[model samples]
Target: MPELPEVETVRRTLNQLIKGKKIDHVTVHLARIIQRPDDIKQFEIMLAGHTIVEVERRGKFLRIIMDGLILISHLRMEGRYGLFTSSDPVAKHTHVIFHFNDGTELRYKDVRQFGTMHLFNPGEEFQLPPLSKLGLEPLEESFTLEQFKAVLIGKKTKIKSVLLNQAYVVGIGNIYVDEALFKAGIHPEQSVNSLTDSQFERLHNAIVSTLSESVEAGGSSIKSYVNGQGEMGMFQHQLQVYGRQAQPCENCGSMIEKTIVGGRGTHYCPKCQLYK
Candidate 1:
């Protein structure tokens, strides 16, 4: 799954490519991918002829702002978007196509067919599921160290699980969670309540620094993830422990190990991230 950085990168790229383009028509090859309106015809009719005003992201979802409606799209694992000329042949697994009046089409392709789209009124999007329950943005001014620590108080869940929960802190996934825990010198299996105030501060900083750096580098392309322009991210080169199991730790030269924590495959340095 694409994390915050990857989703943000896609939002930035799609905003540049599709903004101001009028939708001449919409083609839904997979009917189930459209979750809004329930009726496919209504979905197509509502989107057609509407101009894309902007593209924004909340958590892992993308919102394509139009004249009066907002199209909220979640690109689950293996889903991607690309822009092509209408004359070009559509690629396989292309689930949705937004045909623009300028003879170009924005295509959504998801090999796993797990992507979803929901249409909502302008001001009602955040009041509903998915976006409504998401926690503060880690990079934003609202996510302070005190707020982060306060959320963890009295929680018995593993630190890794707590961070992965979008209700507590949005935009973190398995890869980045492992990296953040490792950077903070906290074992993934550590209980949230076991962390000291100093440890919480370090973890908070690690989360912010890791995400900010990944966004700047486009995001880690560990699998099939790519930006809206079909460009692979460069952050994978900077990974410390996420996919580097059995590799030497950069800080302590200790062998990085992998273990299952809260049902997720977690990687960490045994010596550096000592269990306390």
Candidate 2:
């Protein structure tokens, strides 16, 4: 799953490529990918001639704003978008294609077919599913330290699980969660209710700093992530613990370890983030 930085990078790239481009047509090869309106044909018809006014991102969801409707796209694991000439051969696993009037097309390819798209009226997207359930974007002014702490209070879930919950704070997945926890020196299994104000502050700062830096670096290309132009991200090169199990920690030379927390593989430095 592409986290906040990766999704934000994709949004920036898509904004540059597809904004102002009028949709010539839309092809939905995988009907199951369209969730809203529950009709693939309606999804295609609504976007056929709509012009992309702007591209925005809410958490990990890509919001492609058109004339009166908004297309909410979530590129789940192994999902990616790329812009190509209409004459270019469609790649394998291309599930959706948004053809542009300029002879170009934005292709969505997902090997796992786990990506999803929902079409909603511009003002109604937030009042319904998906977007309605998402929590605040960490970069937004509304996600203050106090708010983050308040959400953690009385929550018995592990700190990692709380951070991963989209209802609590959106756009964080396994990779970035591990990275953020490692940076904050908070063990993935630490109880959320047990964290002190100082630890909460550290975790908050780590989330913001990690995401900001990754967005600047074009997001981490850990798996199949790429931008609108089919470019790979560069932030994976700076990863501290993710996918580095048994490797020495960069900070203290302690061996990085991996364990399953909340059914997800988690990596951290035991020496740095030991159980309290």
Candidate 3:
């Protein structure tokens, strides 16, 4: 699954590719991928001639802005998008295609068929499920140490679990949770409330730095993830502990360990992130 950085990178690339392109028609190869309006045909009919105003990212979802309606798309595990001329042959596993007036098509391909799209009125998008319950954006200036500390108050769950919860903060996933916790030198299984002020500050900084750096690097492409232009991210080459199990820690030279935390595969430096 693409985390915050990957999703943000998609938004940036898609905006550049299709921001002003007008949708002449839409074709849905898989009906179940469209989850909005409950009627698949109506979803296609309404999008006709709608101009692509811009693209936005909320949590792990993409909001393709239009005139009065917003198309919220969630790119699950294997979802990827690419822009191609209409004359190009459609590739296998292509699920959705947004045909633009300029003879170009934006294709959505997902091998797992787990991607979802929901259409909602502009005013109702933020008040509904998925977008409504999400917490502060870690990449934004509002997600300060004080704001993060507030989410940890009275929480006894493992720190990794808390960070993975979208209700606490949006855009965090297993990869980032493990990487950020490792950078902060905090054990993934440590209780949230047990963190001191210094630890809290370090964790906060780690999360932001890890995410922002990944975004700057165009996001990690450990899997089949790609940008709107079919470009793979380069951040995976710089990862420290996420997938470096049994590798020597870059800082302390301790062997990186892998364990299951809250049902997710977690990696960290056991000696550096020693539990209290």
Q: Rank the candidates by TM-score, best first.
A: 3, 1, 2
Against the true structure, what is each candidate's TM-score?
A: 0.98, 0.97, 0.98
lDDT of 3 by residue, 1-276 (tens): 999999999999999889999989999999999988788789989998999898999889999999877999999999989999999999999999999999999999999999999999897889997688998799999999999999787799999999999999999998889889988999999999899999999999999999999999999998788888888899899899989999999998999999998999999999999996
TM-score of candidate 1 relative to the true fold: 0.98
- Give the distance in Å from residue 124's predicted Cα in candidate 1 to where it truly belongs: 1.1
Per-residue lDDT of model 1, residues 1-276, tens digit only? 999999999999998999999999999999999998899989998898899999998888998899999999999998999999989998999999999999999999999999999999998889997588988789888899989987777798899999999999999999999999988999999998889988999999999999999999999998899999999999999999988998999999999999998888999999999998
Off-target runs (Cα >4 Å) in candidate 3 are none
TM-score between model 2 and native: 0.97
**Deviation of model 2 at 227, angstroms:** 1.0
Task: Using lDDT as the measure, name the better of candidate 1 and candidate 3.
Answer: 1
Worst 10 residues of 2 by lDDT: 222-231
Candidate 2 collision pairs: none
As for model 1, its CA RMSD to the true structure in angstroms is 0.8
lDDT of 2 by residue, 146-234 (tens): 99887678888898888889998999889889999988989999898889888889999999999999999999997678888888999
**Residue 8: error of model 3 in Å?**
0.5
Q: Alpha carbon lDDT of residue 252, candidate 2?
A: 93
